[model samples]
Target: MTVRAVRRTSLVEQAVTELRRLVEGGEWPVGSRLPGEVELSRLLGVGRSTSREAVRALIAAGQLHSRQGLGTFVASIAPVTDFDRQLRRAELAHIYEVRVALEVEAGRLAALRRTRADISALRDALAAREQARGAAELVDVDLEFHRAVVTAAHNPVLTDLFATFLDAVRDASTEMVADQGPSPEDHKHDAHAALVQAIEDSDPQAAMAATRHNVEHTLAQLRPERP
Candidate 1:
C-alpha cells in the first residue's frame, strides 16, 4: 500500500479503537453526547475528514448516532445489548451457519498444521471446561477452547470469521443454557475431548465428525420441543 493509504488506514483504526474504548470502558458512557467534531479531531490528532469517516464507520457499526444539526451522541445506553436483542433469531441462525462454514475449514487446516504448543493449549482449554460446573463458567471455557482450536488452525481468515460472531455466539449460548439446564456441559466436554483427540491424531475426518456432532447436539437442546 502507498504511504497515503497506510496513513489513512492507521488514522481510521486509531479513531475506531479510541472510540470503542470510550464507549465500552464507560468513559463517555452510552447515550451520552461525544465531544464535537472539532474537539474530537484535536483529541485524536486526526483531521476533520478522518474523524468524520471514523464517526460514520462507528455509526454503521451501530455504535454511534449523528444528527444533522444537533450533534453525534453515544446512541444508546447499551448499544451492544440493544443490537443483540434487535438481531432476530433468523439473523443469529445465519451467523451460526457462517460460523460452521469457517470453523469446519479451520478444523481441516488444524489437522494439517497443528503444532505441539497448539495441541497443549487445546488440551488446557478442554480441561478448564471439564472443571467448570456452572452454566456461565462452562460456556466461557467452551468458547475459549474453540477459540484456541481455531487459532491452532493458524488460518487468520477463519479466526476473523469467528471473531465477527463471537459476541452473538456468546449471547445465544448463554440464553440456551437457561432452558437446557447444565447437563449438556458433560456432553460438551466429551465432544470437545473427542475433537481434541481427533486433532491430535491429525484426523480431519474425525475432527469434522466430532465438531458437527457437537453443534447439532447443542442446537437440538436449544430448540423448543415439539408437542
Candidate 2:
C-alpha cells in the first residue's frame, strides 16, 4: 500500500521475492494492507493466479497475514531468505555454524559502526553475562550480549534476520544446555572480552576473529568439527 511499484516478473518465486523486498526494505511497512488481488497482479506484471500464489507463499512464510474480510496485511518483515525458513529445521551444529558466520560479520560491522553508547550497552550486557550463575541464566545473559553486538552493526536487515533466527537458536541451546550442561561460550570469557576490545578499538578484523574464536569454542565442544 505504501510502495510505488513491484517489478514485473512471470515466475511466482520472482514475484514473491520482490514482494518480500518491498516488505523487508520497508517500502510496505508492517501492518499495511496489500492492494487487492487484481491490482497486485497488475503491479507485479504477473497473472492473477501467480500473484495469488505469491501472496499465499508469503503468508505461509509468516511474512503476511490474511483475515476473513479485511485484505491481507504485512505480518512481519522476517523470513526474508530461505535460510530463515530452514532455521527451524536445522540441526544445532548447523545453527552454530551459521552463528559463527553471521556473528563474525556482525562483529566486523559493529567494530566499524559502534558508537560510545553502543559500546556502553555491550559492556553492560557482558557484565550481566559474567554475573550469570546457572544454565538458563547464562543463556539469557549470553543472548543479550550477542544481541547487543548485532544491534551495534547498524544494519536493519541483519538485525531482523538475527532476531528471527534467535528463536530457533534459543530452543536448541536450551536442549544443549540440559544435555551437556556446558556453557562453552561462558568458558571463553577472554575471547568475549577481546571482541568488545576490538569493537572499542574499531578493529574490524580483530573483532571478527574474536567473535569466531568465542562462537567456535562452543562449536568445538558441541560438534567437534572445525568450521
Candidate 3:
C-alpha cells in the first residue's frame, strides 16, 4: 500500500475537527465538561487562541455550551444544523403539529411491534408519572412516557428526529404545567393510560386514536378559546 500524505489545514480547523472527534467518539459525553482552553491547546498541540477559536466555533454550531463561572461542556454530539436550530426555536403549535404527526404513526407502529420489554418500560414510565410530586418532576416523567412510546416503535430514524425536539417539548410542557397549576393529572393521565392499554393489546387503530386524543387534549389546554 502506498502512503498518502495528509493535507494541511488551519490549526483552528484541525482543533475543531479533533474536538468533534473526541465528542462523537464518546471520549467526551454530552453534559461532560471539556478541558480548559489552555489544557486543550496543550493536548492538541495548538496555541490557546486556536483552541479558543475552535471552542467558539463548536459553541456557535451548538455542539458545546459554556456556563458562566463553569467550564464548557458538550451540549450534543448531534451537530445542530441550521434546520435543527429552527426546529428547536419553533413555536409550540408548530412543534406540536409535527409531534402529533410523528407520534400518531409511532403509536400505531409501536402497537404492532412493541415487545414485552417495551410494555414494561411504558408501565414504569407511567408509574413514575403518577408518582411525580412537582411540576419539574412531572415534566421529566411525562417526557419519559412519550420517549418510551417512541422507542417502542423500534424506528431509529424516528427516535433520532424525536430526540431533537425534546428540549422544545420540555419547555412547552413546563409552561403548560405551570399554567394548569402543577397537577400531573391535568396533563392527560387517562389518555395516556388508554394509550398504554392500546399498545399493550397490540391494537393499532386504538393506539392511534388514543395518541390523537392525547395530542388534541394538550392543544386545547395550551390554547383555550378566548370567547
Candidate 3 residue-wise lDDT, 1-227, digit = tens: 99999988977788889999999899999999998878888999988766866776676567887675578899999787757654543455676777799999999999999999999999999888878764556677888998999999999999998887776676566545533456434455788999999999999999999999877666655442577
Candidate 1 Cα misplacement greater than 4 A, ranges: 1-89, 183-187, 222-227
Q: In lDDT terms, how accurate is model 1? A: 0.71
Tens digit of per-residue lDDT, candidate 1, span 1-227? 65654344477678878887887788877778888989999999998866765665565455776655467778653444544544534454565666676677777778878999999999999888788755556667788888987998998877887776676676556545543445633345678888899999999988888877766665555444679
Summed backbone clashes in each candidate are: 0, 0, 0
| Candidate 2 structure quality by residue, lDDT tens digits, 1-227 | 69878666558779988999999999888989999999999999998877876776676566886765577899898854656544433456788999988899999999999999999999999888888775656776788899999999999999998988885566556546644665555655788889999999999999999998878776666564446
- RMSD (Cα, Å) for all candidates, in order, is 14.7, 16.4, 15.9
User: In terms of lDDT, which candidate is stronger, 1 or 2?
Assistant: 2
Where does candidate 3 stray beyond 4 Å? 1-90, 183-188, 224-227
lDDT for residue 50 in candidate 3, whole number 0-100? 69
- Shift in Å, residue 48, candidate 2: 49
Once all C-alphas are superposed, what RMSD does model 1 give against the true structure? 14.7
The candidate that wins on lDDT is 2
